[model samples]
Target: MSDASARPKKEKERGKGAGAPRVTARRPTLGHKWLRYLQEVRHELSRTQWPSREEWIRATQVVFGLLIAVGIYIFVLDSALSFVIKGVLGFGR
Candidate 1:
């Protein structure tokens, strides 16, 4: 409940605009922003470490193996549920 907290903070004056219209902050142009983004991307990419061919291949194999195992598990689960539902409803032919 201090007076400082209740009152708004004052902005510092810049370049003799006491009576002049308030000047808005300047923003970078579109081309300048794109160029800066590309520069940052290049900097980050240079710092990245790529895996060896053997390591990459092993990781890819692991991902594919897990995908196949999950597919089989889902198929088995769906088949079992379908069989149970058909038996309960006497819809099996």
Candidate 2:
């Protein structure tokens, strides 16, 4: 069941003799809703499992290495293609 459904309904049943406090539905202003949203985000962030410094460093190194390898491959391919094109056009002679 949803959290809202799990919670007891706030509405008072009729013929219940006790003069319970009347529940007033207060509409939250936009600013108040925004603040509440920020609070929820902060709470969720707190629950996150952050990687250790060593793990972060290792991940960064892997990504950087892959990027460097891909860049070198692209550069070499472009250079080879340009050389082939120039040779075909007799530009180098």
Candidate 3:
């Protein structure tokens, strides 16, 4: 049996007596809820493993290097395609 059911019958009925006000559920206010949410966000951020300065710099360098390499490849491909198209059309004449 549950803990409430285990209680004596007289104790259970005492709160339901004539003078007792019926209990109602209360919702949390907006400001109080926002404060609680901010507290939880701060707690989670504190536990995160942020990257070091050196790691961030290295990652940024790798991204830029790849971008330059891809740009060069596209530039070479476009130049070759233009030359081929020009030759086929006899545009040099």
Q: Which candidate tops TM-score?
A: 1
How displaced is residue 2 in candidate 3, in Å?
A: 21
Q: Report the Cα RMSD per candidate.
A: 6.2, 9.5, 6.4
Error of 2 at 57 (Å): 0.7
Residues 5-59 of candidate 2 have per-residue lDDT tens digits of: 7765544434544676767999999999999999999999999999999999999
Query: In model 2, which runs have C-alpha deviations exceeding 4 angstroms?
Result: 1-27, 90-93
Extract clashing residue pairs from model 3: none
Candidate 1, residues 1-93: lDDT per residue as tens digits? 999787655543334545666779889999999999999999999999989999999999999999999999999999999999999987877
Ranking by lDDT: 3, 2, 1
lDDT for each candidate structure: 0.88, 0.89, 0.90
Clashes of each: 0, 0, 0
Which candidate number has the best lDDT?
A: 3
Better of 1 and 3 by TM-score: 1
lDDT of 3 at 8: 63
**Candidate 2 Cα lDDT to native:** 0.89
lDDT preference between candidates 1 and 2, better one: 2
